[model samples]
Target: MDMTPLLLAEIQFLASFSFLALFMALALALSWMLLFFKLRVRLTGDAGWTAAYRFWVRIFALCFALALAACLPVLAQLGSLWGGLMDKIGNVAGPLLGYAVLSVFVLKSCFLGVMLFGQRRVSDTVHTLSVFMVALGLLLATAWMAAVHSWMQTPDGVAMVDGRYQVYDWFQVIFNPSFGWSLSLTVLGAALAASFLIMGVTALQALRRPPGDGERCAFKTALIVAVLASLLQALAASGMGDVISRYQPVKAATLAGYWHSGDEPELILLGWPDAATQTNRVLLAIHDTGGRWLGHDSKGYLGLDKFTGPRPPVALSFWLLRVSALLALMMSVASVLTLMRTLRRRMDLAALGLFWRKVLVGMSFSGSLLVVLGWCVSLVGLLPYAVNRSINLSDVFSQATSSTLLLSIAGYTALYVVLIAAFLGMLLHAVRYGVVPVRKTTGGAA
Candidate 1:
């Protein structure tokens, strides 16, 4: 008698939420370097801007701590929850994961300590260097994680040995075709999320009272960076879609509720996908642009109707993609308009009107929402296959019993609720109380 792996939707959703928390921290950590470097150059004539640097460093430390805490459970889930997948692929993923933890996390946490505590102890030069190091660590860590996911999706550079997937080329596993584009999108998404969050915080402050020069400066910086990131995201979105259309046409077709194959197919812009009926009712669509949009001679491209396999829910993925893309574009437009207004006012919030202030407050979470949406589109889109063509979800999922799963779900749910509450509570408390006053340095000290 042999036990079989059982795919649990609940477990998958839980794992996704765990990753969401980790990514939120990653975005904050990655964005700190941009904020620091940008502020350093823009806030000229302050002898390395020591006053401003100190203010941002405290905020960075708080975010770093939260991110570190959120990631612990996600790592534990690999062994405890998804034991079946780990039993098979642990020999391969374990080493890659260990290297990332040892190299990236250690480097980041060590430097983060220096940035937080060594401001007065170490020289300003060392502290500034630590900031850059922490940022580098974040990027590298993100890259490693992306590589792991990419390998999972494509499953190249591995061979089946004695009924198990084994890595033959370590370099190939980390350098998959999707690695570069995935990392780029992740970085840009982080920038977008971090920028909006900072802007939102400052905007909330502005609403409480007329913004001071520092507040105005922060708003301007965040808005400008966010707008730039949005533009880049727009530029990257098409290329990413094209890659999916070419490499994973099933996902591309599902994204647009595209079912039947046709020449010069229209791109469905707005529609309600009815998976049961295998049809979509449309309100808007582009005409005869599939070939031009997806690739050269897009008429030659495949469709979801042609795919013969067990697939994920279609309506959910389609709606998610539409919402995420639309929200992203809307934010881009809003950011650009806000940037123009800030520039016209000479970076003074007093000159900024009330209407835009309200709008900014409402739109502060736009980037974070986009981050969550994009993750949904990607992860849900790659369903049924834990390792693309190699490992089906039915073969890689956990084999926990009903009673065990019930207890696990209940326990994890409680734990998740507590962790999320604590994280948000701390963040809110910090925002409400943690105001670092900028003091003029006697001799260029933070």
Candidate 2:
């Protein structure tokens, strides 16, 4: 299909929100984890824990602010760029959107303020409560949006009422078939991203400051979290892929390039899927897990061949799946080894050599990349139809004007670049300047 005006609009909107959501999810995850640590430290009354908490709070605040700023435009674009989609599903989505903005966002922002500034203003218990509330608000906000996406993927309990979709049962909409798996993947991905970010920031701090007890504490925490999250991420991803296999066969098939639905479907770990020829040239093929991977039947499995309609871009989906899996495995090994070395008492946080420290720094963004790749696979795998077998891209954006489409795309791209750069620049400044100067007399946080 050519790049039509509506298609351009769709791409621009997806790109903008995808970038924003990745960082925001990370922030939400970090916010909760940090707050939990902060609560523990408050009770322990350890200066090391206090310093670490203070330092991370700064980074969390930065991500929260940037993510919030980027989110506004996407919300606006839902109406401006894709009004037709809203118009079709307005009755259902409108209420959810309202709740997110008015209830969740409002509560999140209010509690975040308390978490950040209430340390001195409120009692210790109240401050901790504020942190808990902020985390809860963020979680609820994400859940609401995830519900919307789940409905789109596996729409149920909705019917046409006066030519507009009406919710017959809200429970089905919220707890759709894909809801649990999608939420699990999202939460795990967020944790994965946040852990990497924490590791990255702490590593940078090590470059400027002598390893104080607080710095060591933070580094240890980040390392432990990253390692655990990576392992969990691997499992979560497999479960998520399995969910797709059961609910969305076409997407599942495209993911593994399992084009022909038959017994013993070949699992293509690496390949170039050529759709015109309906053949995937495999680099590594495995038949052992094909049936278990895609189905429970005695036969290998049923997948793409079960569907007669047009399939999504198998090459694109396959490539994304492999790349994501590669990054995930790389992070998993790096994290596990690092943890093992620490656990064996072979290497202390302060004693990690420059080589390993640099490696950790490079892998700090792996979580973000992993999540982005997963999103690409899912979104692309649901191709040809924006709302799965029903509503489509062309149907929604047919009214878009071709003349201004390119301009809109450029506008979103340029702004997102600036937003992302600002986010990174903030982190860079924090890394350079946020470290407390070590003193034997008194080691206060920066």
Each model's C-alpha lDDT? 0.67, 0.75
> In every candidate, how many clashes are there?
1, 1
Cα-based lDDT at residue 238, candidate 2:
75
TM-score of each: 0.87, 0.91
lDDT of 2: 0.75
Which candidate's lDDT is highest? 2
Across 1-446, the per-residue lDDT of candidate 1 in tens digits comes to 12222445435454545445445544454446444653464456443344334444555665566566656766766655565776667666777777667656676658867766665677667767777777777766667777877777656678888768788888888887666667677777877876777677667667777665555555666677787889988777777776776666677777767777776577788889887788889889887775543322335656677789877568888898889889988888888777777776765556657777777777766777777777777777787666665566666555667666656566767776776577557656655655566443445545
Candidate 2 positional error at 412, Å: 1.7
